[model samples]
Target: MLLAGEQWAARFEEFQREAWRLETLPQYLMPQESEELQEFRDGTRIDPATVHNEYTDRLRRQATQGRLQGRVHIVTRPLAEYLRFEFAWYYAPHSLAGERIRILDVTDRPNPLDGVQDFWMFDHSEVVLMNYEPDGRQINREVFEGDPAKFIEYQRIAISESVSFEEYVTGFDL
Candidate 1:
């Protein structure tokens, strides 16, 4: 089943214990972010520390409720522009709000999770696969009805192989 609008947004709030995500794309073309992205590209940037938005609000709320929210993004070095924007604008602030963001840099090594698609796994049981076009435009979110054991295993591998977002960004200027 495809999830959209409130149905999709509710998953983050509905997860009882943990909400995890695996991000496989370097750029995600979200329509809502177009204007901000363009402004970023045009040399205007927002200080993540002072930025307040719905996402960060959600992260803060989840953290206050003692729920875990985490994600590991698969990426390569000499990062894409979109990845840079994402790191500076989204990841940085989200981390401050208590989201556990990790980076799996596949620059020199072979990708361990090469064929794995992007997905969100709620409470380690419900999986929602994120479908995207080649250029990174989001298509739809599909609920995966199969057993989520593989996704749980994937999460294990990702967390073990990746570095925390703070560690990953220490030397780089994003």
Candidate 2:
């Protein structure tokens, strides 16, 4: 089944224990972010420390509730512009709000999870596969009914191979 709107949003809120994501793309073309992306390109940027949004607000709440949220983005160095924007504007603030962001830099090594699709696994049992177009436009989110053991393994591999977002950004020039 495909999830959208409130259904998709509910997955985040309703997860009982933990919510995790595996991000495989370098650029996600969100139409809602078009204006902000243009602003970034135009040399206007917000201080990540001051960023406040619905997502970040949710992250703060989840942290206070003792629920966990995290993601590991697979990337290569000399990052894409969208990635730079994401790191500066989204990941930085989200991490500070208690989301555990990690980076798996495969710049000099073979991708360990090469064929794995992007997905969100809630409570390590429910999996929602994120389908996207080649240019990074979201297609739809599909509910994966299969056993989540594979996804759990993917998460393990991702965490084992990646560094914390703080570690990735420290002294690292964007």
* Lowest-sum lDDT 10-residue window in model 1: 44-53
- Kindly report which residue stretches of model 1 are placed more than 4 angstroms away from their true locations once superposed: none
The prediction achieving the highest lDDT against the true structure is 2
What stretches of model 2 exceed 4 Å from their correct place? none
TM-scores, all candidates, are 0.97, 0.97
For model 1, residues 71-105, the per-residue Cα lDDT tens digits are: 99999978999999999888998999899999999
Per-residue lDDT of 46 in model 2: 74
lDDT of 1 at 1: 100
Error of 2 at 39 (Å): 0.9
lDDT of 2 at 150: 95
lDDT of 2 by residue, 79-115 (tens): 9999998888788889988999999999999999999
